[model samples]
Structure formats: C-alpha cells, structure tokens
Target: MSGSDSDRESAKNEAIRIIATDTASVLKFYGALEPSPGEEPLPPAEIVTPEWALFRWVQVQLLMSLDVFFRYRGRVPEASALTHCWYEKIEHDFLDAEYLVLGVLEGAFATFERKLQAYWQMLRPDGVLMS
Candidate 1:
C-alpha cells in the first residue's frame, strides 16, 4: 500500500472506533448493552472494532425503522436518532479514498464543508470574490 492509502485506512479504523464506543456508551446508559439471561458481557476490545461498528450501524438502522413506526404515537422524532453520514462517508472513502484522512472529515460533512471553507475565505465581506 502507498502512504496515502495507509492513511485512509487509519482514518476509517478510527471512525470505527468512535462509532462503536459511542454506540456502546449510549446503550449502556439505557441498560440496553447489558447481557441478558445469564449471558456474559463481551470483552472490551471485542466490543470496539470494525466488525462491531458495522453491527451497530445495522442495529441503528433497525432501530430507525422501529422509530418510523413508533414516532406516529408521539408525533415527534426520537431524540436518539443517529445519523449515518459519518459512517457512510468513511466507509465509502475507505473503499476508494480521493483525499487524505483529514479531507474525509472536512469534505464529507454535508459534502461541502471544505468547499465553503475554500471560498468563504475569499469573501471580502461585500459578497465579492477576492480574485
């Protein structure tokens, strides 16, 4: 692998780490992560990995489907709604990265954060491009 490719992998793995950790923390807060019916809790490292992140990603999707059904009763969205924008961007970029790791975080947020940053800096405050 090339230098840039290795960097992309590192970024994806880091994203996996973050998503897994956050999902577990949220579940634990609600006692949903606890083992049931005499089952043993998973090991620390086992719960936070690429595989677990993917699992939780799917799990979240299922929960969202449930929300779609349940939200009608409350007439409001769930406060626990999770967005997949981060997971999606990282996963796609990991398959074929067009930029460095830093670029993933910068560009994939709503798909235009860096574009705004690139041009916003040129604004003269009079709505004119610097050039």
Candidate 2:
C-alpha cells in the first residue's frame, strides 16, 4: 500500500483501540456495582464509595457523550459543532439523572445523596470522545 493508505490504516486501528478501551472502562465501572454469586448483598448506600461514585459519574457521562456523537455522526456541519452539541446534551442529562438517582436513594440514605451529588460535580469536567 502507498504511504498515505498505510497512514490511514494505522489511524483507523488507533481509533478502534481507543473506542474499545473506553467501552471496557464503562463496562467495568458498571460491573463493579453488581454482586458476584454467593457474595453478601451490601446496602446501596454502603456499596457506593466516593471514589466509585466519581468513576461512575465519569463513565455515565462518557456513555452519554458517545451516544450523542454517534447520533450526529456523518451529519454534523463541523467537528466543533458536533462536540458543542454533545456537551450541551450530556451536561444537562448528567445533572438531571444525578438528581433523579439522588431522589430515589434519599429516603433510605440521605447522606449518600449529598456525597453522590458532590462526587458527580467534582468529576464533572470537560471530556472528549473519539469521533
């Protein structure tokens, strides 16, 4: 293959690797919450640590961002426009979901609600997903 073709192939492989890595990270974050067979069931409040909450928040945000990007893929007017739109939607959805989850968990664990909200915001910085 020509040099340009070879370069394109390498870039494609790199992009695939990155996507696979992000997907694995998302799955791992969610998987940690599941109890293994014969494992004792911890209460929801006890299960979510601050660190885990932060990681979960990031993974959820990443997943939402990926969804938005994929939805707009091949149709966005410009790369920046795609990113701008994704961020707008993801940020709104993240806050909405966080509060919704907090509301559901509040009756049983009020403290968890505060911790989750804090951790979610603490980890809420700009993120980019591979196109």
lDDT of the structure predicted as candidate 2 = 0.46
User: Best candidate, TM-score-wise?
Assistant: 2
lDDT of each: 0.38, 0.46
Check candidate 1 and list the clashing pairs: none
Off by over 4 Å in 1: 1-32, 45-47, 50-62, 74-131
lDDT of 2 at 124: 36
Stretches of candidate 2 above 4 Å error?
1-24, 27-51, 74-76, 79-91, 100-131
Q: Write the per-residue lDDT of candidate 1 for residues 1-131, one digit (tens) a residue.
A: 23575675575445434432455543443344456788987545445542344343333333333333332432433456535764564365343222222222232322334523332222112232222
TM-score of each: 0.24, 0.30
